[model samples]
Target: MYSRLSLSWITSSWAIGLLLVFPVIAIIYQGLQPAGDLFQHLMDTVMWDYIRNTVLLILGVGVLSFAMAIPAAWFMAMCDIPGRKYLQWALMLPLAMPAYIVAGIYTELLDFAGPVQSVLRDLLGWQTARDYWFPNIRSLGGAIVIIASVLFPYLYLLARTSFLEQSVTLMQSAQLLGKTPLQAFWRISLPLARPAIAVGLSLIAMETLADFATVNFFAVNTLTRAVFDTWQGYGSLHAAAKISTLMLVVVVLLLALERFSRRKQKVFQKNMGQESARLLQMKPWQQWLAALFCWSLVVLGFLFPFSMLIYFAAQYFTDSWTTEFIEFSLNTFFIAGVVAVLACLIAILVGLFRRLHVQRGSDIPARLSSMGYAVPGTVLAIGILIPFGWLDHSLNDLIEHFGGKGPGLLFSGTMLALIAGYLVRFTAIAVGAVESSINKIPPSLDMVSRTLGHSPVKMVRKVHIPLISKGCFTAILLVFIESMKELPAALILRPFNFETLATYVYQFVSDEMIEQGALAAIVIILVGLVPLIILSRSIEQH
Candidate 1:
């Protein structure tokens, strides 16, 4: 009976994994098929530009994020600075600010006719455009800066933890050897934390590659935008799928680099207690400088944009408040809620299987399902559309042959497609959350339950579920929040006339009228803050 149950568990896990991963496999298989002209035309025209822009965007974001994050991480982790307690986590606030929203706000302020340059002109006594050489904020360089500003937090979080985990003896030894603080950091600390830094860099790079709205707003022709334009403008799924494949190539490379970095992770990261490491005490002036540097990142990355959002929301309260906004808010909530529940179920299924099975290849289903998280949203959408679109046509054809009215687009043109895309993209978050929680459960509990005549199913229902309930809830919240913020997949898979708050907010942002959507944008930002709150509390407790 246990063997039978084991077979059932493996079969169910595999089935779900294959279904979720099917779109990716389908897209890749379809991408490889010969596309005679339009694909060739795409290759001849904008392909190189897309590749170049994507590479540059990644490279630029990597460099800029590293510069901002490493110093801040070191200050927060090693030096005794004002507000270190809060500043360490406050640095993470920018992660809540969507890249496109930041791009829009900065563009408005820095553009030629906007307040920043206008103020510069007024102060510098320059009258005309030819008289001054202000930077162009709508260019590729601007996109890099804006995206990096928000994304640097990923590096800060990881690097700070890595620094905190280092043994204090090494630092003291370097100091005793007459090395200056800066020199010690450069020679000893930086090399030890290289793996964490590399891992963080890979995350920043992947996110930069995944960004679509920011680049689209800037008119930068990266692979994401290329996929969108080719499919929407040119009416060629074949071309879009091929472009998506190119993006997958980049994502794969980044993932490979991230995994390689992690291979050296255990060697460098010993679990030294944070409090055991003595912090450096800086001079008053140096302390002030450090505080300014840290707070400036908080201000630019989060506080400023968030404050601007609040101001716009208040000023345009009447214009932004509408029946449409409420309806779309409900729409966003409904879809996000459904995806959250479904994703949590998928997570529990696969994660528990991995915990129990423990045999060779047991991890594959979870890994395969998690792969979608690494995929760019645009690529995932194209992958989903290819197979689901075919199934929709086939279903309609079958209905027609049976002399019955067909359910038009039952799969493709409804909430089904959108939900499927969310599951494919975000179930990974749920799985990771659930698996982490499960690992914390004592193995003796599972053994005791089985000895007491509990079946695997009964044991999980009565014991594991209650223990991991908090994790389950956390997983739901994360998936829901991510689904709410998701744009690229929603843009592609949403039913006609459907609008989530993200897409709704994006419409106004794209039209250069962020004030109109400020209220909606605020909702997204507030929702993104939930997990951050949880994270801070967890770190404090630890």
Candidate 2:
């Protein structure tokens, strides 16, 4: 009976894995069969520019995020500075603010007629563009800042975890050698944290490469934008597929680099017998400076943009409030909730399979399923449309052959396609969370349950489910928030006359009227805080 159950589990896991991977395979296949001369035309005209801009943007964002995250992580994890407690979690709030929204707000604020420059012009007695030489907020540099501000939390979270987990004995040993605190950190702590930092950098790099909205809004032509333009602007799906394939190649390379970095990671087991290293107390001036640094990041990244959104929401409350707005909010919640539940179920299945069937190839299915998280939303949307559109057409033809009217777009333009995209993109988050929680359960529990004649399903239900309930909740909340904020996939796959909050907000942002969608944006941000709060509390417990 257990053998049959295990076989069924492996078969189902493999089936889901293949379904998730099909879009990528379809995209590559389509890219190989491009429309006449379209691939060549893109290569000759704009491919190099896309490549150059994308590399530059990735490098710029990676460097800036590192600079901001590393020091902040050190200060939070190692220094007894003012506001350290509040600043630790407050720094993560930026993850809720989408970079495109930030770009839109700052663009309006810093534009010539907007508040910042208007004040500057009035104070400096300047009249025109040539008066005082303010920087353009719609340039490559601007996109870098916008993206890095929100994304630095990726690095900060990991680096701080690394810092906190370091063996206290090592740090004390360095200090006992008469090394200054700065010297100890520079020579010992930073080197030990490199693996974690590398993971953070790789995450930042993948996100930078995958970003479409912020760079597109700023008019920086990265490969993602090229994919959008090739498909929508030029009406060439084949060309878009080819560009998406190239982008996938970049993602694969980044993944490889990340794996390589982790190959040498050192695990530090805490010697609970020994006292942990003490946090350094800062002088008053240093404390004030540290407080300012952390508060500046929080204010600039989340608070300032959020305040602007609130002000705009209040100003346009009556105009923006409507039955349609409520309907769209419901639509967003309904779809996100459905997708979250589905993703959580799939993640649990995959996690159980990995734990129960620890064979040579057992890990492959989970890895393949998780790969979707690295693919950009734009790429996944286009990839999904190809195979799903073909399936719809094929089914329609089959129906017509039966002397009946064709069923119209059962999969292509419906919520089915949107849910598929969301599952492919976000199931990885759920899988990671669930698997981490599962690893904490003792194998002895499973053996004891089995000895009592419990089936595998019964054991999972009676043992694992109760044990990992918190992780399951985390997985659901994370996927739900992500699906809510997801813009590119919703924009492309949503049925006609349908609007999720993300797509609705993008429409206004694209038209340079974010004020109209500020309320919805606030809702998205508020929902995003649920997982972050959970994460902060978990870290505190650690």
CA lDDT, every prediction? 0.90, 0.88
- Tens digit of per-residue lDDT, candidate 2, span 186-264: 9977888888888899999998988898998889999999988887788877888989999999998988988897786
Evaluated at residue 451, the lDDT of candidate 1 is 82
Query: Of the candidates shown, which would achieve the greatest lDDT relative to the real structure?
Result: 1
Residue 293, model 1: Cα distance from true site in angstroms:
1.1
Candidate with maximal TM-score: 1
Task: Give one digit per residue, the lDDT tens place, for model 1 in 332-390.
Answer: 99999999999999999988887777677878889888879988898999888888899
> How far does residue 6 in candidate 1 sit from its true spot (Å)?
5.6
Evaluated against the true structure, the overall lDDT of model 1 is 0.90
User: How far off is residue 440 in model 1, in Å?
Assistant: 1.9
TM-score of every model versus the real structure: 0.97, 0.94
Error of 1 at 44 (Å): 1.0
Name the lDDT of candidate 2: 0.88
